[model samples]
Target chain A: MNAALSWLESLLVLAGLLSPLMLPMLYFLLYRPKRRDGLASPIDSLDARAARPSFFQRWHCGLKVACLLATCFLFISPRGLAVCLADVAIALLATALSRPSWRRVLARLAAMSGFLTMLLLMLPFSGAVQAGEPTYSLAFLPDSLPLRLSGLGAATLIILKATAVALLMEPMLSTATLADTLHGFRQLGVPASLTQMLLLCHRYIFVFQHEAARMWRGMRLRGFVAGANAASLFAIGNFLGMLFVRSFERTQRVYEAMLCRGFTGEMPRAAAPPMTARDALKALFWLALAVSPLVTEMYFADFMRFLGE
Target chain B: MHISDGVLPISVSVAAYVAAGAGVAVSLRFLRPEDLPKIAVVTSAFFVASLISVPMGPTSVHLLLPGIVGILLGPAAFLSIAVGLILQCFLFQFGGITALGVNALMMGVPALVCAGLFRWLQNGDRRRAMCSGALVGGLGTALAACFLALFLATAGENFFAAAKLALVAHAPVVILEAVVTAAMTGFLFRVKPELLCLPPRSKWRGKGDCSL
Candidate 1:
């Protein structure tokens, strides 16, 4: 039993860490594609007594930040990249080849390849990327901290690292989260007021983004050039002010509209289904996978030693 | 630049996470649903803003805007900064997953201080407000270095020595942070003058000053 458990542990580690690329690829294919409509999604179903998609049905939030957090949990896990990628490629290829028609295979290939390319671009720009630098090591420490204060400090350190990772993962996940807000959270049984708020926010986000971009272009055209070296940042700041003003005014009308429709802090209902057992399992599985690194390094001597802590 | 797993002592890293978490929780207390989008915009702005880098010395360091966030969001500044910091860690590997908290506080607290100080600045001279943002931006970077130093010191006894060495390592970086922050402040003044405004004085008269 012990030997079998050990093998299972090894497999879990590999699944969690070694194959980062594999999971993302699978997720992209399976995600039922986002919002086939725009932010004001033309009032869903348009039938009396049918559920409407609360104001911002067609918009995406910044939930990518949340997905990235889950991704980091994978990065921390110990696994074999080559094996994972090869396995995933095989899965994709199998799916493609098994298709009854040539057109479907080509479409699949194009989609997969396009996705792979975006990840390739996103990585360099991702804040999570670490540059090569010398790291502090803890090899020469005594087995136990010297006293209670040492233990206190030990507790402090763990909190610090967790905060760092949480902070880093939050924004990235927020984007994916933004994208998946209504569908994902609705499944989670989030409050309607909260959902309505997020939907509204998501809908208007592009307005801010557009304002920011326009201000940026305007500033550049005016020679307020902060600098690619940094002279350009002034424009970015000034743009923020403009973005805020427009967003603020737009928000007032939205609030009034909601109030008129009996939106007493509670959002109108959408026909989102409840969470299923499959989603529960999927959530737990991913949670485990995300925290697998700490688990692996904590429990497995071999992996811990391999990581050279 | 945020250190990750295996980069720092486990004890120091964990402590940072806890403290930063507490700080974030405090911020959440005053949070309103409406603040989410503003926070998101600020979060995206901070994340994208760093992509524009400035060359200093042999290497380059991007802007750290915890101060600016603090100036804009006050104590709630932590949420905006945390979101941006988390995204950076995951996607770009700007910092380590393990070191997220310490980084946040190092940056977050300073921004908070700057936000408060910006308010106290001569009752809303736009230039003073920008200066406050500038100071917060630079101060946050400097404080982060100190927090990092303190974090290293607790890594073990040898880290005390390492902290000394690390202080020297951060000196030039601090100067650069100040320069960029100051430059950013000056730029913000010319481009976005509204962020420096203290929410129409009526905001402070309210019970809680929280945003998402």
Candidate 2:
């Protein structure tokens, strides 16, 4: 069962940790969300426009992506090397289709290679033991070392997997997941009020994050630091105080706004992304792919028994 | 405080899944159509009033504001906590899958109680209520620990030994958390009393009009 999970979980953790990097990559590669979406979007809809890269853009994107994939493969060590190869194929296809300048491609490729070499040399992920030995360690990191190649490999893989999960799965899952959760509550006969409360709370979270950021920044400019004692302490107290007052006032405004718009008990809806056969098939395919590693481990790979414990 | 997937027993996990549903059911009845705006407002209040974390040994634990939620929103706090927990889990993995329900209950039920306490303390110096909140917060943590201990105990675990180890180890951590919670709540009272509820119709008005 861990076959898919091992990779997926690690990937998610990686994505969560390296969100800053993965977010930009995802933005470049995927469909850009826009102002029109805001009517339906619960979060703030700022101009999420990205300056489109030109012909060179595609190649550079592809090249950079391939390099990321290489690093990811070197780290996660997905049970079947096939997935890594598939990613490589995808990267190559993307690069080919993108058709960047050859000179730039060569340079980027060299840079990619150099990055991996430096990562490999500077970070340790290698060890004396053979693969599938049931090495019980955090990503099988050893007791003593500057940087274990195996550990580095595992760490990188974990992060890469997270990025992949975040990029590939997040958009599809978020709304559906929210809906599913709401659906589950409704089925249980949870009151609409409670359900609505849940939804509103979720909606307001973005507002909190946004406001908190702005408030914190304003506070900082006015001399608020989390660590400093006298100045920082007083500033934090004042900043927090102001944040409270502002938050209180903001909610009232937001509430009044919602009321004016006829926010009934039900959450506003647009057409949900339709569930399709492709989605079903893809889901099944992924399940099988993820499960395969566990099946393999059942027979030839007792390695995890030692490794997991 | 968020326990991970493999941390709890199968029974505990299963029971929690069921209980999480039950918690939702219990709170659902009081919600009204007009409540949406207030829900929005209170929720907005929750977002701010909730932050201002207190520093503990290595980590910082903030005010859960469970009591405030319980008082204002009532059982709706269950859903609020649920949504908040889900976001926190997805965004930061603060509390992993297995511990999600327990974590929710730990923070949720207390807020439910805090709502009641809010009424009790509204009149006399409201600042003291924050102190009560700070203290009761520890009770919530203790209850969570006990539930977790019971979970391990029923599974043939050395619950006492484990509790001793965990509680002893985490005592300073807990107090540090409590102190910070208290201090932050204190700040909330002085700063954003509106977050707890609406600002008095006028802040400058005398205390006679400030009655809860």
Best by DockQ: 2
On residues B1-212, what C-alpha lDDT tens digit does candidate 1 reach at each position?
Answer: 45444335556656777888777667655777555545555555555445444445455555666666666676677766766665555334455656678778767777777777766662435566556556666677677667766765564553454455555666665655555555555554455445444555523334323343
Cα lDDT, model 2, residue A297: 55
Model 1 lDDT tens row, A42-81:
1111012112232112112323223334444443333333
Return the interface RMSD of model 1.
11.1
Highest-lDDT candidate: 1
Candidate 1: stretches off by over 4 Å: A1-210, A222-309, B5-15, B31-37, B55-60, B89-93, B96-99, B124-133, B156-212
Candidate 2 chain A TM-score vs. reference chain A: 0.39
Q: For all candidates in order, state the fraction of native interface contacts they contain.
A: 0.08, 0.18
Per-prediction TM-score, chain B alone:
0.81, 0.67
